[model samples]
Target: MDRRTALKHSALIALLGIIDVKKLFAASGNNSEIRGFHKFNLGKLELRVITDGHILMKPVQPNFAPGISSTVVEKTLDANFASKSEVDLSINILVVQSASRTILIDTGCGANFGKDSGWLTENLVHAGIKPSEVTDVVISHAHPDHIGGLTDKDGQVTFPNARVYLSRIEHDFWMSNSPDFSKSKITDEGLKKMVVAVARKNITALKPQLHLFEDRAEILDCIRIKLAPGHTPGHCVVQVFSGQESLYHVADLVHSQVLVFEHPEWGFEGDTDFELAVKSRRKILNELALSRALVFSYHLPWPGLGHVKKQGEGFEWIQQPTVLPD
Candidate 1:
């Protein structure tokens, strides 16, 4: 972490100190105030989870049935106090401020996607952050929700000066071919409609900022990108370090908190490769549980901050404690 990033981070949180958490949640209404983030200190580095919005989707199908009984899913939801059937997969964007740079882990679905989605920008501004001030934009994958905010409504670059980093596979998968939506089970028209906000032409032109990176590439001094593929071809997780303390920004390694942990093998129709996604999910979950490092899950309740733990034949996620244990 550098001095400049440190200063910006402190200023942003100090800004949030003025806003009441209850009032922020209340303003969100039915969307469920999932946009506000939780901030944690890693020695000198400051980590804040800025929520974009959420996805209310039906479970991934017959797999969502027997593999993890709806009964268990429902019970888990009840225990977590989350709404049943339609799960709210919250989208969280991470802003890491170290001594060197202010980096955003993944840009959330920008302001134009859906009424419920695309709140990242607004929330960032609310945190007293300017888009232009973001030094590096590290993309976990090229999925619409993760990358749609890369540009604005006018088809212009969203982060004009920031150097955008993405995995080689992720960039190729989305930019190269016309995705075969037929196999996706999602209607072609529907897929087209979903991507209408961020068409190919707009993405093609803004080529300079999007730099393809390989595994272990250091985006900044303390932040390193790891290729945790499967959710998307080049899906990734960013590891942030300051002294001995670290946090992993586990992007899309898990979607619905219940679905991913309780039944790691279940396929999400949204994932490009279902089998590989399961493999990646299980691998990451195991590693997370063992490491016991604080993790920032993009879609695991508001603020999306927690740690994974080993459970009966699987693993359980425990939210990060609000206060350090004495």
Candidate 2:
């Protein structure tokens, strides 16, 4: 090789040694990214949207947002100013401090799926609340992402002192001998079985601490379970009341902030019953729009606190601005 080429290669290698590219990438992945947790107060209640982690669903075609053409999906994403190639689904867990009870709405994806997720325990610690400090864990459904975090990889209970709560119907659906997913859009039997196995494993592990409540049961005199089945047999939303202020925690009602809001009738591939999911989405979105109450969405952007506004034929999510602490 020529002397000039050798000199250039040597300088490049020297720069690489000084730069520490691995450390730069590591910092980009961990330290440089914004922290996940958000805390605020609602009336007499202290509320927080803790981060669990996130998943990016790719293809954005028939699987991610079913019952629509790829062209339509592309147009919708363009209109919403989101990436036209992928769908971003964030796992935002709701934490409510009611009286002496520390209530957690849903645990995040624990040791499941990808490495980017399963950060619930770590993030919760960063939020100044230990898993043991959680007095109550209210589960919205039996989905893996919602209940998988209840236990660690070794099948150890994460919240040792917390009493787990879930709908009786939801518990039975997964615990039943034969789970019927005939109405589901997902046609892969093996994939469905894996999902069922995860739910059953997590639910069974927490059975001792699990407290099954009837639909619409008001537990702790502050949290009300609103029956919004469709995503699952026993899927529901939560209504948290404090003094005169209220926070309606709509768990997994809308996966996409813009697409779901723009077309409530559309089907999500994850929904067990697409038709029922659409109905529930429309019902809750309409009620929220009319009441103008605060809504907490689990799958929207981080700290998914917002209000629903009725648009022409559908609804729109109006994200609530973060208020600074005094």
Candidate 3:
């Protein structure tokens, strides 16, 4: 080998030696405890975002964004430096503490989904919250990921002491003996069957503690349930207000932070009614953008708290900077 080539190789080896291998491994390791929770104040209420990890899913064609072309999807993803093949859909559990109660919105995917998820309980503990301490489990919908953590592997209730709340329409649709599968636009027969079965099993297990409510009802003190039923028969977004400050927990209205915001007309595969899903998304997104309200999106990045802003014909997600309470 030439002297110049040897010198270059030696320089590279020296640089590698200078790096701390152990520390590098530790930094990149999957330490769930450290990445588990985030807390912020909302007036007198304390809001916590408990992560249940994330699922790496391939972006399905047609269903991912029915209105947008494949070329557009590829270009947008590439521009964002996101993987064209797959995207990580994060499962975030929202916790709210008021003077009267401690409410949890949406349980995440349980152990049955995959190993990549089901860390909600572990993270809750890391956040200093006991399952029993949770006064209410307000479900945004009965989708598997949102309600899967309601029961444990033994088919027992996870939050033993908390009262379970869900939209009446959502509960009825899932519990129905004959649901109209045509509305969902799901071509995979096996996947559709699995979703129905999971919903029935989980909802049945929580029936004893279930408290179903209608739209616009004040389920809790300051938290109101707003029916946004396009994702499912009864998907709902929660509005939590204390004085003039408020936050909207928009569950599944926008699946991908980039795709959904940029093309509100795009449809998510999980939506039972694709057209309705788009309508609800556009309506809610417009209102949220106009009001400039802080939002908590379920499938966005971790902590999922952000703001919607108008961008040309569509919108954009502006993630709130992480700030801890005093």
* lDDT by residue (tens digit), candidate 1, 214-282: 988886777788888766777888898887988898888877666567768764656666677778888
What are the runs in model 1 whose C-alpha is more than 4 Å off?
Answer: 1-37, 59-82, 180-189, 192-202, 323-326
State each model's CA lDDT, in order: 0.70, 0.81, 0.81
Clashing pairs in 2: none
Model 3, residue pairs in steric clash? none
Residue 185, candidate 3: C-alpha displacement in angstroms:
2.3
List runs of model 3 lying over 4 Å from the truth.
Answer: 1-35, 60-63, 323-326
Error of 1 at 275 (Å): 0.6
Model 2: lDDT to the true structure: 0.81
For candidate 1, the per-residue lDDT at 318 reads 88
Q: Rank order by TM-score, top first?
A: 2, 3, 1
Q: Write the per-residue lDDT of candidate 3 for residues 205-275, one digit (tens) a residue.
A: 98889999999989677799999978998999999888778899999898888778988877787789988
- Per-model TM values vs. the true structure: 0.80, 0.87, 0.87
Error of 3 at 260 (Å): 1.0
